[model samples]
Target: MSEATETEKPASSSNTTLTNAQKARIERNRAKAENLRQAKLVTHPYKIGPNGGPEGNSVIKVQGTKYIDSGGGFLLEQPVLPAPGQKSNAEAETPVVIDDGINIPVKYEECLDCGDQFADSYLFNNFGHSVCDKCRDTEDRHSLITRTEAKAEYLLKDCDFDKREPPLRYISRKNPHNVRWGEMKLYLHLQVLKRAMDVWGSEEELMRQHESREDKREVGKARKYNKQMKQLRMEVRSSVYTKKTTELHVHEFGPETYNEEEDNYTHACVSCPYTETFEKM
Candidate 1:
C-alpha cells in the first residue's frame, strides 16, 4: 500500500507539470490571435462624418505610409520624393542612349580635302564619299548634280550608272519645280566626272565625243527643218494652184539621120525635142 501511494504521488506531479505546459501553450496562442486581429483592422486618422465615411480628403496613412484612394477600388501610395538638389522627373531632361549590344569597331576614311580620318560625314553618308563635312563644298566641289544633267553632260547611259560594275550611288528628292512630278535622283558631280572618264577613257575624249554629237545633232536639225519647209511649200502650191489633166502626147518624127560608122539610124521628133536611135536588126 505504501509503494502504490508513492507511485500515485509521482503521477499527480506529472499531471500538474503537463497542465502547466498546456496552459502556457494556450496563452501563447491567444496572444498570437489578438496580434492577427489588430493587424487586420485598418484605422484611418481622418474624422468620421455622420454618414460613417472619411471626411473631406480621401488620403489615408497606414504603417507610416500615406496612400490616396485611387477611385478604382484600389489605393495608390504617394510618389517617392526626389533627392535634394535633383530636378523632378517632369523638369528633368531625359538623355538619349543607344545600346545595340554589338562591339563593332568603326572604320574610318581619310577625307579627300582635309586628309583627316573620319568615321562619318554628310557626303560619306549620302554618297559613300570620303570628303569630310568641314571640307565639303556644296556649291562647287561636292555639289549635287541631277541624273538627267549627269547623263546629258557626261554622255553616260543608264548602264554606266546602274549596270556597270560597282554601280554609282545617288540620293532621291522630291522635284522642287513640281512636287507631283517624279522624284529626281541626284548624284555627286565629282563622281559623275569620274564615271565619265571611265566610260570615255579621258576628259579630252569626252569633249571630242560631245563635239561630234553636237555636229550630228545640228545636221539632223537642219535636215528636219528642210523637210518641213518642203512640205509647207507643197501645201501652199496645192492650195493656190489647180491641176488640169492633159492627154499623153505622141511624138511625130521630123526626119531620120544615118550614122555610117555605128551603122545605126537616129530620128528626131517634130513637136518635142525627143530623139530616138535604133539599130536595124
Candidate 2:
C-alpha cells in the first residue's frame, strides 16, 4: 500500500450511517410501540406482560378490547350493548316454557310472548307454568268464545300470596284442545326464586353440618337439629315470589305459529263452535 497522505493518515470508524428513510422508518416504529404500550397500560392498569421491561423493549404489545357483533362481516371496533330489538346469543339460548298465548321464562317470570309477569287471582298454575295477564285475558276471551263451557271451574288446592298457590285444579270436559291444568304451574319471581335457591344451598350446608354433629349423644340436641331442618323446609315451601310486566316487541299473531285452533280463532271460523273445524275451501 502507498503511504497515507498527511491529512488522511488514519481511517475513521467503519460503522455505516443510517439513511434518512431508514431513520424515519425507525422513528415510526418507535411511536407505534409507545402507543401500544400506553394502551396496554390503560387496559390492564395492574401489571404489564413479561416483555414489558426496557431490556425487552423491542417486543410491543397491544391490549385486547372486547368486541361485539356489528351484524357485518367484521366485529365492531369497540364493545357495545346489543340493540333493544336484538338479543344476545346467550339470552336467546335460554330454554323457554311456552304456554297458550304466553311464554313463561324463569329468567324474569315474564311472558315469552308479551313479557308480562303473573300476579293475583288472574291465573292459578303450578311453578314454571305462567301466562301473562294480557295473554291470559286474551285466552280467556277466546276460550269463552270457543270453549264448550262459559266459565271453567277452578278448584283451589293451595294459595299463599307470593309464597305458594293453593293446590288448584279444574276438570273440564277433557277436550283434546286443552292441557291438564292441574300439573301446570306459574314461574316465581326471578329474584325471589334466586333467594329460594340460596336458601336451599344454605339448607344443604346446614344438613351437612348436622350430619357431622350426629355423633353427639344429646337427645335435646337432636331435637334442635330436627327443628332447624323443618324450618328450612318450610322456608323453601314458603319462599316469596314476584310479578312484573315488561313490554317487548314480539311477533304478531299467526295461525301457523302463535295461535293454533286450540286457543285462538285465527285458523278457525270465528262463529264456529268449539267442535267445528274450518273448511279447507
Candidate 3:
C-alpha cells in the first residue's frame, strides 16, 4: 500500500504541473468563457418584424423589447421614450451655464486719429498704437518704415529701437527686394520719428547733428581721396625707379686724371659704371 501511494503521488504531481503554453491557453479559455457568460446575462430582448418592414430597419425586436441594432453584433437597450411635449433625459440635463454678464468688461482704447474708443485695431494690435483701422494711413502718417530707413533717416541706433526703456515694436517681413536676404524688420514711422526726437532732444537738434555729420563725412572723403592719390603716386614712382641695393662700388680707380681746362681730378669706378669728379686745393 505504501509503495502504490508513492507511485501515485509522483503521477499526480506530474499531471498537475502544466507547461507555460498550456497555462496561457487555459487562462485564455477561462477569460473567453467569462465574457460569454456576461454577454448571456443581458439577453437581446428585441426582434425583427415578420416582413422586412420599417420596424425592422434600424432596430432588432428580440423576444419582445426593441433593441437598437448598432450595425455591429452589439445591441443597445431601447430607452423609455419620453411622452409628447417632454424633453429626453439627455436634453433635460441642464447644459453648463455661462453668464455673459458675469464676464469682465473689455477695456477699449481711444483711437489717436478718430478719437473713438475701439476694442481692437490693426495698429493697436501690432504696434500698440491706439489707432483705429479707419485712421491707418499706410502711405504716410501711420506708414511702416524699414529698420535701415529708420536708422538712416532718424539716426536711431539698434539700442534706441531694442534696448531703450520702452523698446519700439516692429514686424518682421520677408525681404521684398530679395527673398534670399534676411528678414526685414518694419517699424511705425510715427514711432520712429518720436524716438528720434527723444534721442536727440528735439527735431532741431537732430537736424543740427545731421548737418555736422554730413560735414565730417565730406571731410573724411576728401582725406581718404588724398591718401589714395598719394599711394598711387608712390607706387608709380617706385615702379619707374626700380630701386636696387647693390654693394657700394668703392672707386677702385686705375689712376686719378687731372682735367686740363676744368682743373679737377676725375675718377671712374672699375666695378660699376659710376664716375666722380672733384677739385682739391
Candidate 4:
C-alpha cells in the first residue's frame, strides 16, 4: 500500500509541472499578439455631400479605401458597399430655379452690375441714385466732390447772400443812409469768420490736448492767436456803437445873390414881428 501511494504522488507532481509550462507558453503568445495590435494602424473613409433631391430623398456615402492589421502575419482590406439604388444621382440632376427676366419673383431681384441682391443697394448723393455700397464708394472716389465736400457746399448755400439789391434803395448810397445794410453785411461776415475760427480753434485744441509734452510747444502760437481773437471779438461787440442818425436838412435858393469877389457868403437867422405889433395896437 505504501509503495502504490509513493508512485501516485510522483505522477501528480509531473502532471502539475506540465500544466504550468503550457500556461506560460500560452501567456507569451497572448503578450506577443497584444504588442502587434498596439503597433497596428487604421485608415478611415472620406465623405462629401448628401444634398436633398427633388423628391425629398437623400443619401450619405463614404468613399476612399480602408486597411486594418489583424496580426503581424495578416493584413485585411475592408470591402466597399455600393450606395443604395434609391440614392441615385438625384441631387446632381436636380433642377435649380433660374429667372429668365420674365415671371421672376420680386424677392430674387439682383443688381445687374454687381450680381448681388437689390436689397443690399445704397443711395448715392451725387446723382441721387441707388447703387451698391461697393460701387458707390468707387464712384465717390472718382466724383468731383465727396460726401463731405457736398455737405460743406450745402451749408455754405444756407448762409449765402442774394446778389440783387434790397427794395426801395435802387441808387448807390454811402455812410449813414446805408449804415443798416452795411452793418448787416458786416455782421454776417463776422459770424462766418467766427464760426471758422471756432472750428479751427477746436481742432487745434484737440491736437494740443492729445500731443506729448514735447510737441505742445508747436501749438503755443496757435493757442495765443486763438485767445487773442476771442478776446478781440468780445471787446468789439461790447464797445461798438450801432446808433441810427436822425437830422433834417434844408436847401436855400436866391437868384443873383452871390458875392462875386469871394464867391461865398454866410446867412443870418431871421425872426417875425407881426404878433408884437398886433398886441400893441
Residue-level lDDT for 170 in candidate 4? 16
lDDT of 3 by residue, 180-200 (tens): 999999899998998998899
- Compute the lDDT for candidate 2: 0.43
Q: Which stretches of candidate 4 lie over 4 Å from their true place?
A: 1-77, 80-144, 156-281
Candidate 4 positional error at 35, Å: 25
Using Cα atoms with residue i matched to residue i, what is each candidate's TM-score against the true structure? Answer: 0.54, 0.14, 0.56, 0.17
lDDT of 3 at 13: 97
C-alpha displacement of 29 in model 4, angstroms? 25
Ten-residue segment with the worst summed lDDT in candidate 2?
A: 148-157
Model 1: per-residue lDDT, tens digit, 135-193?
99998888999999999999999999999977999999999999999999999999899
Q: Write the per-residue lDDT of candidate 4 for residues 1-281, one digit (tens) a residue.
A: 99999989988998777577789999999999998975553322222225322111112222654443333445445433446664335565788888766675554335445767555443422222345556544433323332223224323332232331221111123345566654212112223333434444654653554464336666887879867876666566554334444635333423233344533343432332211100000
The whole-model C-alpha lDDT of candidate 4 against the native structure comes to 0.42
Error of 1 at 169 (Å): 0.4
lDDT of each: 0.83, 0.43, 0.81, 0.42
lDDT of 4 at 27: 96
> How are the candidates ranked when ordered by TM-score, highest leading?
3, 1, 4, 2
